[model samples]
Target: MTLWPGLAADAAAQACPAGWPQWDAFARRHVQADGRVVDFSVPEQQSTSESQSYGMFFALAANDRARFAAIWRWSRDNLGAGSDKLPAWQWGRREGGSFGVIDPNAASDADLWFAYALLEAARLWQMPDYLKAGMALLGQVKAQEVRVMGDLGPMLLPGPVGFEAGRERWRLNPSYLPLPLLRRFAAVDPSGPWTAMVQGAARLATQSAPQGFAPDWVIYDAGKGFQPDSERSVLGSYDAIRVYLWAGVTNDGDPLVAAVRNALAPMTRAVVSYAAPPEKINTVTGAPEGRGPIGFSAALLPWLKATGAADALAAQEALVREKWQTWSRAAHPAGAAGDGEFNYYNSVLSLFGWGWLQGQYRFDAAGQVTPAWACAA
Candidate 1:
């Protein structure tokens, strides 16, 4: 088992940092006072449910209840997030220059994360309101997001609509199903299809990566197995990076961990060969192209450590640490990192990757979060 810093009273003497400076920096750069996580990189300056969900999870992990409540409020007010409605996936400046929801469609992954964060927060903070909201939202997820495929049993679609390409063909994003969350849901909602989803998720992770490289999106035929998505081809890039992150941070004792890790072994080799993860790859041919962004390096940290690629992990750690100093740590006058306007996604990735390395938090076998303070207490 990984020994998290501050797990013991003497941990402070071991020179662990006082708090999560990275998360503090992220909040300043991306999160607004109104608790909206705006991506200033794009002209729309969009706020997606994914961003809000990530914000809530990070806040919970940092034990910042006030910020958590604020973020939840903004999402509830703007994104239509509540027990009765699945949060709208995207909000931004509209064509008329007025800010509003750009897309009414809900992203199932964000829905899961939102529910997970709320459920965990309720348990950790002993708040019944959070629990009530979480269970009700989870009910919506079960009703709308899950579908019974021909033989795949209960599989999670990417959203409530538009993903079912045909009567028998369905589009799936493998990265959306984090094993840890599935484990937690299985424990919390045993009567639901969470257990069956766990098994299906394992197949998605392993079978989708026939060449040991996960595709950004895959097509699942009712009778046939997984195939490269027609729209996305065989490419793996931004969306697939989270697959490694999810697999890496999953508790080692989970029965499906080894299979998922083995399926993603090619990523480790690519990182070693190029000295960093590739920005994109042809999942079918195992051909890589271009050096990935700093966020890609950050995304690989936990996976490298988990896979025992010590040298690769060191290199990525060094690169991330070096580049991290280039960005400002305070809220800028323009409400975005000037040159690092694209920092929102990278920062979230780092929070998950470097945060794990720094011992800020961890996931148990049942997918319960173990924040550093919780361990110390």
Candidate 2:
């Protein structure tokens, strides 16, 4: 999808500052030359619209305009398939044929990231095309993916299709709603449902976790309220971890900020009690499953700090730092796509959680990012 007209080749403008090299290293290791962020642990060497959207955000945060453009290009030409403004969620090697999008359904979280990153890139870098594209895609997301439940107000469906399990019910992913992004979207269009989504999102987090653990998926009963998705298992693991990370890093004073803190506060105790957050928790029962991996520690650092659990923050930071070394060793000569310890998802979480904690990026109340370089400037 080599459609971008061109970009200047100045290294200084194209790269993050020398001191902030982790993102650069991460791109080098995981992002392919074709602008695809490949998750190697998956046997198919799959790519997701979510990864592309995330890479765009990181590139914008690092001020790497070139990589951001390339990622956008690849996602549009490949996942978007040159037709849809919204890119398909998953792309990979098919069982019998060439590599391409396996499904055309747009994932709401990925679409949200794509729109948010594009608009923010426009603001941060003065790319008007990015802003225009972002607005267009945002409309598609709202038209095709967002819905108003019987009582839940406006809500983002997990995808454009297939989330409706049956009549009068829809499945929702809480982590899909980034509070800061919702605020930003509302800023873009005051009359948009984004603001209502902010309220609905807060309600989602607080109500879904009766026991203080967000579920990976919840069902809106139209009558009863948010309930656990038995198909996804009641356990909160990979998908739900990011909920805490996003909530913690959200700007203070957001309407949902207090709700996030209060709803997830038990995680602070979990970290202190176990020296690490549990790897899996039954969201309904609030029971521990196992000692969460190093990445879980990484994910909790910002949340721990946000909740004023200094000792817990310190413990997680220490564990996260130790795991960074493990990543280095696992990545040095052997490589980054390892088996158990430093996998693709773990690396991604570390980048977001640890990077936020270490001051690589911060989202303002309006969700405008003050990246590390911009901070110093």
Candidate 3:
């Protein structure tokens, strides 16, 4: 058995510092006092359900009970529209600069994250309300987001509407399905189709890439299996980076872990050959397009260390240090790091990557999270 990196004792000594400082600063800067996680990089400075969902998860991981409660309250009040159900996907400045939920469609990815975060938070913090909200939101997702395909069983849709490209074809984002997250969900509701989606997504993450890198999105035909998405370009960059991140951080004991690791071998090879991970790759040919940012390095930390790719892990670690000087210790004007604006996605990637790098948290085979502080528990 390939034993993944665990929370080291010395590392645990610095566990509090090993996590959430960047996101904390990020929350202070971008998350308004109103609880909105505003992405200042965008012109409209919109806040999506994705931002809110991820914030909840990060807060739980950071063990920031106060921030988690605040974010949930704001999302419930504004995004919920008093419905007490799934929050709308879009909020903040719209086309005419009006602030509200411009679109009410619930994003399945965000919904899943919200539910997963809630369940995990409840366990970690022993909060009943979080568990209640988590189960409620999960039921909503199981009813609305879950769909039955011809052969794929219950697959998750990108959103409540759209993404259905044709009568026989549907678009899917490979990066959206993190194995650990899916596995965690399956554990919560074993009778549901979450396991099927887990298997399907695992197959897609590996099968779609000839060179072992995942695509941002792909078309899943009922009979043809996975193909390149027509609406999006054939390149994988921002959206696909998480595919690797998800695979990298998964607990080693998972049955799907070895398969995902083997399927994403091209990423390992690329990180070794180029001395760091490529920013993007051709979805079909596995050809390198450009260099990735420091966050890519952060995303790879777990998988590298997991697979015993010591040199690759060491190389990416060096690159992460070189790319983000404040990576080791939170240093920045919150999102305005050096000349570039704060990358919301990059920060997210770093949370998982750097969190593992510092031994802050790791998922077990059953998908329960083991934070550094909770090592005994």
Give the whole-model CA lDDT for all candidates, comma-separated. Answer: 0.86, 0.80, 0.75
Q: Model 3, 10: alpha-carbon shift in Å?
A: 11
Sorted by lDDT (best first), the order is 1, 2, 3
Least accurate 10 contiguous residues by lDDT in model 1? 6-15
Backbone collisions counted per model: 0, 0, 2
- Model 1 agreement with the true structure over 1-377: per-residue lDDT tens digits: 33453234343222233589888877877788889987777788899999999999999989988889989999989998884789999999999999999999999999999999999999999998998888888899999999987777899999998999787889999999999999999898999999999999999999998789989999999888788886757899999999999998888878999989998899999999999999899988889989888888888888997898989998999989888765654345434443372377887888998887777778888999987667555
Q: Which prediction has the highest lDDT against the true structure?
A: 1
On a 0 to 1 TM-score scale, where does candidate 1 land against the true structure? Answer: 0.94
TM-score of each: 0.94, 0.92, 0.90
Error of 1 at 243 (Å): 0.2
Among the numbered candidates, top TM-score falls to 1
- Please report, as a residue range, the 10-residue window in candidate 2 with the lowest summed lDDT: 1-10
Per-residue accuracy of model 3 over 1-377 as CA lDDT, tens digit each:
11224434442223433445666666776676667877766666678889888888777777777887887888888788225566898887887768888788888888888888889988888888888888888888877777777787778888768888787778878877877778888888888888898888888788777667788888888888778875787778888888878887787778887888888887888888888778878878878967788778888888788777988887887777665665434544533533252377676677778776665667877777776556544
Task: In candidate 2, list every pair of residues with a backbone clash.
Answer: none
lDDT for predicted candidate 3 compared with the true structure: 0.75
Better model by TM-score: candidate 1 vs candidate 2: 1
Name every residue pair that clashes in candidate 3.
279-292, 335-342
